[model samples]
Target chain A: MSGAAEQAPVLQVRDLQAHFRTHYFGVNREVRAVDGVSFDVNRNEIYGLAGESSSGKTTLIKTIAGLLKPPLEMVGGSARFSFLPDWDAVGRAPPEVVRAIRWRHLSYIMQGSMNVLNPLRRIKHSFRDFAWRHLGGSKAEFDLRAAAHLERVKLDPSVLAAYPHELSGGMRQRVTIALATICKPEFIIADEPTTALDVVVQKDVLGMIRTIQQEMGSSVLFITHDMGVHAALTDRLGIMYAGRLVEDGETPEIFARPLHPYTRHLIGSLPRIGDTEQREGLEGTPPNLATPPPGCRFHPRCPLAMSVCTTTVPAMIETLSGHRVACHAVNPGMAA
Target chain B: MSALLDLDRVSKSFSRGGLFSTRRVAAVKEVSFALEADKPEIFTVIGESGSGKSTLARMILGIHTPSSGQVRLGGRDVTTYDRRAFMAEVQPIFQNPFEAFNPLKQLDRYLFMTAERFGGASGKTAAEEQADVALRQVGLSLAEIRGRFPHELSGGQLQRVAIARALVAKPRLIIADEPVSMVDASLRMSIVNLFGRLRDELGLSIVYITHDLATAYYISDRLIIMQKGVVVEQGPARAVLSAPTHPYSRQLRDAVLTPDSAGAFRAIHSRQAVATPGVSS
Candidate 1:
């Protein structure tokens, strides 16, 4: 992770930590969901975050999105979005600035687009409500721009008249994409955008995302646990474990040669189309984030564990190419 | 080879709209397949949202009554079984783990309930032991999960607990409805692999329902592809997936995003279905 200081990372997360501290009938405990993780999602680049359930991938994304609520608290570190550097600054920018930047500078496309759409309103109304104000155009012009964006994503312009319920699952997702991209935001946070769609629909949605990102040159913080999806769509990938990014690198290199034992197990377990090799699943469960295992959190289940692995946490090591991994067995020279 | 579970021309319809303008929405139309008890293979039912895969699964579990045809379990009509008998012979693993179990209640309660209700356990000790055994089968322990609520555990752990609860009944068949879709990517394989293990080791026949062709290709032995209530393709999992004869099946196979073929996936979906477009919702 060299030369991290010189460049102004679009999303600079330094020692970013999030914890789920809870009191269970007077038993106070803290699950370190995102602990001491550091990474930079560079401008106009797709940085992929991969982790299984309980690996703290979702918690990390939620923190980045400034949605820390309830037991989930940002205990330590900083998640500084280039646009929103401070917590208080969010939603407090000058009306004109916020209006101009919100849908135009930063946008998010969620897994289930239905969440963003109002079922009662026609699909076009949802777009008008969010982007119309920022678009700074006449009603006719705004409608025209929205429709053009829809066409770019291969959605029929007629979809604007139909309610969210009237459209198919795939169509609703494409509408959400159009809504997010209509403003041509420089940064887009996509959380498993195609995870819910069918195989065929997933392909179409992912392809649209790839095409639009390439054409627009917008930075995307793509979060999903599916390595296959990550490998297919992301240019760079980061592996999250117990809330920390244990590995980060080019997607192709990570898929071809994973260094972390956990990453190895994760990639090895993926079932290919024609391959029949019996793959062994990782044993034991992910540590309870509220009270995760000591030292290397993955030591209990990692195939290659040492005595040091149980006591001293491993630092993220740059082994080969641009690949960085965190594991005592894999990178033994790291000073913990 | 005798069929363990069979669906013959099964159809499910829901009446919507006003009294005069009642519209018949066919969720599952003429879907048919057979799972052999002797084979004990992972049979996959793949479909998108409106494809009626879930509806077919609910019918198999006797949760929903089919409008026409029959759903047979172990060569007996599924609808014929009363509530108690139906639950004991078949079990279901729902998609969302958080929604599958009550968030307020302890996770062990479901396990104990399953043991007492279906496993014929006599006392708390026996039921606890049975729960522990089932948990162990899924690579979990009762001690760690005994008192945890749905929120306390991760989605993968909760899903594993859901699968364990289904297994306590010792049912001949299990119907997993998008079991791993809600789970994290890394944790997905463990759950899918458990299905294969259960079939091979315990002789449990599983009807794995999912939209993910990668995991389906990885775990399933045979599969039935569904599109808007119709079985578009049905055959051995490998044969059907590798060399799909049907256009819809081929589209599905090509739409799957692998590491090497991510860039070309959209072209596969561009060729829209030439068949009549049904109501997608």
Candidate 2:
């Protein structure tokens, strides 16, 4: 892990800000979906971003992957990949450049496997549509490469002849992963890949992800709300709250001693088997990002919020060697 | 005392493909279970997507009749009971909160309607009063949900409202199919906890269906594990989960990813690596 960190980061995202601009009739509104997020995915390491729905994790990944359209705009920030260093501005990259880099240098495995694999076509055709152009080979050669890739993911090559609907959910997801990594990209963005899967199949899929990432030495940006998945898979984890990163550290360190109050509540609320001693849910709902509270976005829900917390926004600062947190109560007397 | 709900060798089958090339597929095989009338408990049915858990739930709700066997409520077969009489004794909470209600309508309409239709409330004032009582049982009030639309409320609030709607009829049993799965993690426990409270205080029997083992262990008194429409294991929830005897149940338990089970990933990964020699170390 230390050696992996010593190498240059595969993906560096600095102060990224993505907001949703909605106009209904004449009224204009702005939802700050991803507000000043910064993180780094070290080479060959899995960085997990943990956030509940509408915490802007999906928006952040979409912004990074340059999938943002109108209404959803990347106002500021730079997402630079080691392979595409010349194009520091990922969100604003040219279509040709983005297309050229995709599948060869960067690939994505989204939540719904159906979204990636076409239901009307056979699995092999979907593979051909995605990775065939990226791989410089004839049709027969590409077919061989595709079969070999499916074998790597522990899927039968016979699945290529069947439609997406024919394969089971878990099998289709594995095929999606195989398609994404067919060219052996340098970086992969997996957004809740195994979330739709059952627990039994989820473990196998995650094991495949870890094994494939380690074999290819590709940096993976894994996003899911499940802390259990993060504990088992990720090397480092960043906790997101109200569109802002509240904490970031090694997986075990953050789980053992979470610095931020929100992180503490998030990890503490998880229900485990053999432990049923009246676990309480966090009171109040996540703050609405469109009209978030003043100062800190989470101050209204924070149990230890103080007077200063209402007027001053906390900055993410390093308290331990590599751990960082954004809470005034945790890092008292720290200049805002 | 007679059993409240009795499932005797119930089975459901569905046909696929075109008219000429039709194939029969059994969604749920001969499954049997019963709930006693005097005692209330949480009975859980655990299974994966295609494991026929949903099919069993539909049969219990009378939405789909079993191809074989019978589903009896209070010693009377469910198929013979009238719609109003059956709904008055049994209710359901669906998986997705957003889809359970109409987005354009106020959230309170369903509660008020249920009260009027099933609670013997004729007047608007009487319906409103009954709705308020039911909402109070779920820790909500008529004021908070008076004119609010379904989109205005969060998933947890909407689910609680759904539960309140079910309670308006004073049903003996509630069939919740993955109710909390769509809710946020931080708010999930509150709903699960509410079920526990309902069983204790309100004397409501619930059939909890889910793929999540942890929550199933927390609240269920008895549970059955299903695999591809067949029940592989059934017993006391805590005892069975703590020490599963079936090979499939043990495999499912071992596959569960807990915070403490980080080593399970490495073990599975190495085993997979050996199975597929194509993966370069």
Candidate 3:
């Protein structure tokens, strides 16, 4: 927690592989949900992951959160967190160790607020159920802390008594953010937190998340398919396609000059106000993970795909300092 | 040279309570607009949940009769048309393609059924011919989707099939409710572009209802911004969005998350969160 060690990335994931192995009837198949992905979430920085659905972003999040179950198994590599030097990944960490770190060191804010809160229970009980065990104190002290935290997040303390159904979607989401940050965790993984909300609500919630992360000095791994959200919130950005990290760079750099063809397509496709240029949708669908295309998975739809990309897998290479891309077209001089 | 679709101060209210004290809730409040029969255009309705956009679409599709005023189609009250004849003139494309089609049924069956019922096809071959034509318009061929179930196709492919099904009826107007919201980024523009193409090539007026204002600006010829069942602003899509006069419309436009907006939003974080609205139906 001090000196040069503080400079290291909070989370270092290397060559990670997670696959969904299912045996339906007689056929046994493996969907390479997250194949050979690697990234670093630095301390006190918001790292954004952008990709289309079925592109393995969600699977990657689940694997990182240690929420994997039967059929979805981690096949290879490690996700090392700075907090736990003894274990390489949360998935490999034992139940006792994981329970200790679940909310104290790492927390998650999901899309559906109702899913986090028990519908039948009051907001206070839901907060108590999750945080009281982690933040053990006298019941009175804990209640005071919870109310203070809710007020800090701009909710009326009276809302603590209200049921989840009574609060609006935006308010419920704000409560979810407050609950996630109450422990003052070092890292927060927000999975499409604002996707369910409208434009007005989304902007305000994102502002709160930004403000809280800044005030708490905690790193956040923000994942969403929306480019605008990534542009508005993240410091660093990574683009995933077919379970692989295709591009990673500073958010502004990635937006200014997107290196990978898929990244280019994703950035180019976004329609904005005042701009009247026609944006053509990328052709073909995302690859089916169970039977992804050989070599580069995005080749079928990629306009800049080369002969080398069809046969050989491109290694991630730095075209510019602090910016990395894994595409044969971008780094052609490199040996295949 | 009559109006293709005319809504004259239409209003719809639903009873919300049990037997003791039932109170009427106005879902749509006196909304009015019209599309010309000869001039096909993509008319967009922009609103969030509970904004009455969907309710208005249903009334246009003849699902609900307006509580007051008139919804005239081909210069006649919408309720006056026979149900089957009404469907032949207006088809609907729902948000989720997975839910729109039966999981057990083949995708082509939906298209063929629409063709047989609305396209005046008599036999299987006749239906197939009409279905294939509609599918081809959507850049999909019958051979590729003939025996494929809804689960077998991707969300994008399934949505295209839904659009194809709508096209199969050769309807004069199509009502798409949040059609591209469930679709991925790669295919979203294609589906949105498909709407514009449907207007130009098929001469079909599309009542595209959605919350995504960016896409509404991109494809729509005319648009109305609805807030809480009221049309706060209505005009050409570009002019209204580029320079909205209404305060609510301006707020909605300002809320759009772009790179610049995100950069400029650092100040809003300092503001109190309680000032934000709590309830949106």
Maximum-lDDT candidate: 3
Please give the range of 10 consecutive residues that has the lowest summed lDDT in model 3 chain B.
Answer: B272-281
Best by DockQ: 2
Tell me the tens digit of each residue's lDDT in model 1 across B1-281: 78889889999999999989999999999888888878888899987778899889889988899999999887889888876777887889999998988889999999999999988888999999999999999989999987888987778889999999999888889999989878766567778888989998999989999888877888898999999999999988888888999999889887776665643422332112212111110
Comparing only chain A of model 1 with the true chain A, what is the TM-score? 0.91
lDDT of 3 at B229: 85
Q: How good is the docking of model 1, by CAPRI class?
A: acceptable
Candidate 3 regions off by >4 Å?
A: A1-6, A333-336, B19-21, B260-262, B265-281
**Residue-wise lDDT of candidate 3 within A218-332, one digit each (tens)?**
7789999998888888878999999999999888889899999999988888888898999899888999898899888888998998887777788888899789999989888
Fnat of every candidate, listed in order: 0.43, 0.44, 0.45
Top model number, TM-score: 2
Model 3, position B259, has a per-residue lDDT of 57
Candidate 1 per-residue C-alpha lDDT over A32-112 given as tens digits, one digit per residue, 9 for 90 to 100: 888998887865567888887667877887776656777888877777667665443323344565555566777889887
| Model 1 stretches with alpha carbons more than 4 Å out | A1-9, A19-31, A67-100, B121-133, B140-148, B262-281
Give the higher-DockQ candidate: 1 or 3.
Answer: 3
After TM-score superposition, the amount by which residue B113's alpha carbon in candidate 1 deviates from its true location, in angstroms, is 3.2
* A211 Cα displacement, candidate 2 (Å): 0.6
Sliding window of 10 residues with minimal summed lDDT for model 1 chain B: B272-281
TM-score of chain B of 1: 0.92
Give me the overall lDDT of model 1: 0.81
lDDT score of model 3? Answer: 0.89
lDDT of each: 0.81, 0.88, 0.89
